[model samples]
Target chain A: MVKVENLTVRAGNFEISDVNFEIPDGKYGVLMGKTGCGKTTILEAICGLKNVVGGKIFVSEINVTALPAGARGIGFVPQDGSLFTTKTVRKHLAFGPRVHGWKREKVAGRVKDLAEDLGIAHLLDRKPHGLSGGERQRVSLGRALAVKPGVLCLDEPLSALDEDTHAEMVDLLKRLTAENDITVLHITHSRREAEQVADLQFRIEDGKVVQM
Target chain B: MIGARSDKPFLAAIGALAAMYLLLIVMMLVADAIYGFGVVPFRSDNPDQVSLVSIFSQKEVINSIKLTLYSCTISALLSIFVAVPTGYLLSRYNFPGKLLVDAILDIPIVLPPLVVGLSLLLLFNHLPTKDANFEDMLNDFKVPFLFPKGIEVTHNVLGVILAQFSVACAFSVRTMRNTFDQISPRTEQVAQTLGCSRARAFFSVVVPESWRGISTAGTLAWTRSMGEFGPILVFAGTIPNKTEVLSSTVYLEITTGSLETAVIVSLMMVTIAIVVLVAVRMWDRRNEGGLYHG
Candidate 1:
């Protein structure tokens, strides 16, 4: 569960003002906004990547607004897939476990498990450049889930993809989340994508969420 | 009255220039081919003189090559550690003196080698060996490299390393900072929200995304360090077998009238350069061919 209240972020020559929203545990929430409406900045502020001039963030009941992005326990997938290009798919999955200090065998097992589940089991040896867009998104999603965060934040995950693959990826994400019981807060400008994946919808216009 | 026009002269001029350029290139190839190996031929009759096999086989020459390798590698690694962080900070965050840092970094990339060496010489002067200001500062710190005072970072291999490190680092940092600017900071934020520590997020997410540019920067830095002549010669001195890297070693050999030895050393440097070219091509392939396509 993630709760963000009175979130305000000030960057150079731009500021996102007075944003408030929530994604309950195990539910899917989508934040829809047109370009430059400060959607991504909200995620950055919540994760502590951007300094919030005013706000509070609670992830699974702990106020983590002042904490660094890494301490927030919110899994995030960028629109670009943003996988580490240097590592193989398996190695990428293994990264989260390594950061969390999981044992070698445990990491290996989790990677294998996620590979099978995400249908990327065959591409374990390949790096990000070799994967198709859908394949890459799956790997990025798998990498985030492998960390076992309290909430998963996906920023425009399926935007660049073609229609068929986009639908497939949406379904794939739904199945993965249901299996893991992960709460999701996905950002998108596409109303159709939000309709496909969202359990609750909030629209951001000029830096404020208008619930719909 | 009749008028005629032809593109002949312009085409001919272009063809002539092309031919001349090709000839110049071939002449370089010929020179490389002719003196590439020593004048002694494959087998020579002078036991006093070191043959190709001997010059190529000498532990000193080999050691210099190996030392060049180690020094270049160390310089590049150290430069990346400092360069990447500094470059990222400078690129992403703006504060007072940012422009000053940018100006200083660009100096090494533009300055002539001789000027650079002279500047390093000035920096190395008034060693804390006898300087009161540096001596007092040294006493406050507990580094072992200095004597009871500041002793020898200059006139030693350390001096060469430092000189090359600073110059190469500046070049690399500029290139790397551009690479960092290309990255979407959103990627890092996403990684952090995924429970990655700041250190881990940088290592896993940001570094990998920018790996190609960083590798190219490292290569450029290393090649510059390897080919650096004036600075090492000025500050470190051309001490035979110790501070003698490939460039200065060739210079010393040629000046001492060891023409054959000099030629062999030059050939060795060429071979090393060829190896770097092959490595760069392979690195390019990996960067383009593989993906975390996200």
Candidate 2:
């Protein structure tokens, strides 16, 4: 479970004020808003990527507000896939596991399992430049899941895909969340995406998160 | 129709001027190299006179070449070591006095090389003097293997390396800063979320992505060090078999009225510069091909 209480963040001239929300354990929560409505800022703040001016962020009942982003154990997939162009898909999947001190053999085993589950096993040897948009997103998802975080944060993971790929991704995300029992805080601008995936929905209006 | 017709002649004139400028430089270099070849037979007329063959036969000239290679290589590598972190800091962070720090970094590049040499010389001149009491402390001070005589800078190999590095490092820092600026920060943030600390993320993600920029910066630093002259001349002095580099060799030859030897050294420098440039380009192309195919 992930919770933000009275969260206030200031970035440049913009401010997100007094936001309160929670994603209950093993549920898909979608934060929907118009563009530039501070949705991504909220996500970043929860993941410790952005500094919170006032309030606390709790992950699995632990107050991670003062923790560094790397210590938060929150998986984040940014808007773009942002895969390391120099590394192959296999290496990308193994990066997080290696960072968490997993041995080489364990990392290889985890990478194989993720690749098979994501249906990207065939593309393991390919670089990001060679992968299509859908394939890159899948690799990114695998990279995020490689660390086995309690809560996964996705910033518009399907915004770059076509309609067919979009539906396929939504289904895949739902299945993954169910199978892994992972809580999710997904941000999107599309009502259709929220309806298709969210178990609980929240909207950002005038820099506030309002549960709907 | 009239404007289009008028633009054609103007564009053609600009293109012709650029072509002429490029051809002029190539012609001058080729002419100088060929002229050096003609002086190969004149060495037997005077023992002090220099010819293409005699320049290589002279121990002083050969030693100068070796010294130039050693100092340039060391200075270039040192510049790269300093440039990587400095570039990353300047590229990624915003803090108080950032603009001031940036301006100071560029001072070496913008100032004349003679000024750089003069500044270094003045700084060394202010080194602590050994008094009777200090002599006891100095007796126990051990110098490293690279500095045999206890950290002497002026008129020494250390001075040569320092002078070259002062200018070379500035160019390297600029190149690496531009390289880091072009990379997206999202990749680093993602790495952090994946349990990698900031330093680990930089090494695993940022460094590997920037290999081309690192190569380009190193090449520029090496080439700049090879061509450095004014600073070394002013600071290091033209000490034969010690402080003398290829550039100093040319200057010394000219001072001794051996214009042929100066031309020979210049020709050798030009050849080495061309070979280094071509090799760097080929390596970049190979990496680019690997990125596309792999």
Candidate 3:
């Protein structure tokens, strides 16, 4: 489960106050709002990238409000699918596992499995610059899932893709998240994207998060 | 046709201005090359003039070369070590008095080289209490293996390295700060979210992506150290076989009326700088397409 309780985050001149929301375990949640409506800021706050002014964030029923981003056990995929530029796709997949001190064999096995599942096994040796937009997003997804975090926070994961690639990625995301039994909080501006994948839908309406 | 022709004159004016500087620099290099090779015997009075072979044969010149190479390399390395963290901090955070701190960091770069040398001299020699300066204090607690008599930096070889490092590191810090500024913080944030600590993320993500910048910074520092003279002259004091670097060697040669040898050494410094700059530029070009936008 991923939950935000009375979360108040202030970033420069923009601020969100007393926001509350939750996604049940193994379910997909999508948050929709217009541009500059504080969607990415909320996602950042949840992932521990932004400091909370006042409130609690719980991931898998554990209070992670005071924890650093690394200790929050939350996976985050930014808008650009921000993969480490120097690392190959395989290394990207293995990064979290290596950091967590998983055995060499386990890391290799997990990387291979993730690559196959993401259909990026062939591009494993290539660095991020060589990958297409869809490929990059898939690699980003694999990297996020490498450590098997309790909750994944994705900010407009398919916003950069073409129509055909977007539909394919949406299907891939839905299947993969369900298969892994991971909770998700995805941000998107597209209503069609919400209808396609969201188990629970929330929108920012007049400075408040309202469930749809 | 009229608009296009009018723009041509404006373009040519700027181009001519740019070419004037380039021509001046090229003319100097050409003059050095011609002078370096043209004269049969460098001095007319002295039949046995200093040739390239004779220059290297001298123990003092050889020692100066070794000192210059080793000390400058070490100074460049030390500069990079200090620059990386300092640059990263300046780039990533918004702290109180950030502008003040930034200006303070640029003091070594903007201050007259003589002032920098004098300040270092005073820092080591002048303590407020005045019981003993930092050097003497360290010398008092001298370890048998390390500082048998006393740790000597002022008027010592170590002072040569310090003087070079003090100025060179400022350039390195500036380069690294700009490098980090060009890179996005997005990848690092993502790394942190992947269970790597902030330090780990920096090492894994930011450092790897910063290779070209790091190399450029190190090279700039190294070249700066090579040309550093005023600080070494003021603080280290050129001792023929002890503290004499290539720059100091050139000065020594000129003072002793060995004009040819001084010009030859100047030519050598120019050649070394050109080689290093060219090598780095080529390496950058070779690895160009491999870099990511982030």
Candidate 4:
């Protein structure tokens, strides 16, 4: 479960105040908002990328507000896929587990499994620049799910994909998250994407998250 | 046809101006090489005809070359040390007085090299005079470099390195800041979410990505240090065979009326600089072609 209560975040000149939302355990949640709304900001805050000045954030009922981003145990996929430019697909998938001190064999096994599951086994040796937009997103998704975090936060993961790729990714995300029993908070502008993947839908209205 | 005819003079004028500037630089260098390689009488004491090889084989010239290489290497490494953090801070943070700090960082770059040298000379000479000054305080605290009655800095080898660092690091810091600015923070942020600490993420992700920038900055600093003359002349002094570098070797030879030797040393400096620059460019191109993997 991922929960935010009265969270206030300040980013540059803009501010989001009194924001509150929750995604129940193992449910897929989608956040919708118009351009310039605080959807991405809220996702960043939950993932510990932004400082929450005014409230508590809970992941798996643990108060993670005071923790550094690394300690929060949340997987984040930024809008542009934000894959490490220096790393290949295999390295990207293995980064989380390797950093967390998993054994080499375990990391390799996890990487191989994630690659097969995400249909990116063939592209594992190739770096992100070699991959197409959809392939990049799949690699990014595999990277996020590499460590199997309890909560996953995605910022406009499908915003750059074509219709066919988008639908395929939506199915892939749904199946993957369900199999892992991960709670997801995805930010998107498309209502169709939300309807397709979201079990709990929320919207950021007037700097507050309102359940729909 | 009319438009094309009208554009001829403008295009010719533009090409002429660029070609003229390039020609001047190439002619100057080519003339230096031709004259330097020519057998010119350099030894005033013994009038045995001297060539570039004989002049460069002199102990003083060899010492200057070694000092220049060693001091510039140290200065470039030191610049990297100071620049990486300073660049990251300037790139990523919004701290108080950020603008002021940024302006202050550019001081060495904008300040005249002569002024930088003079200022450093004065700073070192004047600091110990004041009661309870920073230098004295460091002395009191038994700092490693300051112990034993505060080791002499002005007119010393250390002064040469410091002088070179003061100017070269400014360019290094600027390059690094631009590099960090170009790279998105999103990758580091994602790395953090993947369980790497900020420092770990910086070293593992950001630093690896910044290889090209770091190389460019190091090369810029090193070459800048190599060519640094005014500051070293003012601060370190032309202590031949001791504090002398390649730049000061040119000055020393000129002062001693060995214009031929000075020109030869200048040619040597130019050759060294070109070789280093070409090597760095080749490395950057190779990395861009291959190691820039996605």
TM-score of each: 0.81, 0.92, 0.91, 0.92
Off by over 4 Å in 1: A103-109, A178-181, B1-26, B35-40, B46-74, B130-150, B178-187, B206-218, B239-243, B253-261, B279-294
Docking class of 1: acceptable
Q: lDDT per residue, candidate 1, A73-145, as tens digits?
A: 7777888887665678888788778877899999999999989999999999987778888998998898888
* Candidate 3 per-residue C-alpha lDDT over B64-171 given as tens digits, one digit per residue, 9 for 90 to 100: 989999999999999999999999999999999999999999999998988888988876643223345566655644322333234577888889999999999999
What DockQ do you compute for every candidate structure?
0.37, 0.66, 0.54, 0.61
Total clashes for model 2: 0
> Candidate 1 iRMS, in Å?
3.6
Worst 10 residues of 3 chain A by lDDT: A82-91
Q: List the residue pairs that clash in candidate 1.
A: A74-B193, A80-B294, A82-B294, A127-B291, A128-B291, A128-B292, A129-B290, A129-B291, A129-B292
The candidate that wins on DockQ is: 2
How close to the true structure is residue A162 of candidate 3, measured as C-alpha lDDT?
97
Off by over 4 Å in 4: B1-17, B38-47, B126-150, B292-294
Each prediction's Cα lDDT score? 0.81, 0.89, 0.89, 0.89
Candidate 2 lDDT over B1-294, as tens digits, reads 655556778899999999999999899898887788776564466776555567688899889989988998999899989999999999999999999999999999999999999988887744444432455446545322233334578999999999999999999999999999999989999999888789999999999999999998998999899999999989998899989999999888889987878887898999898998899999999887666334
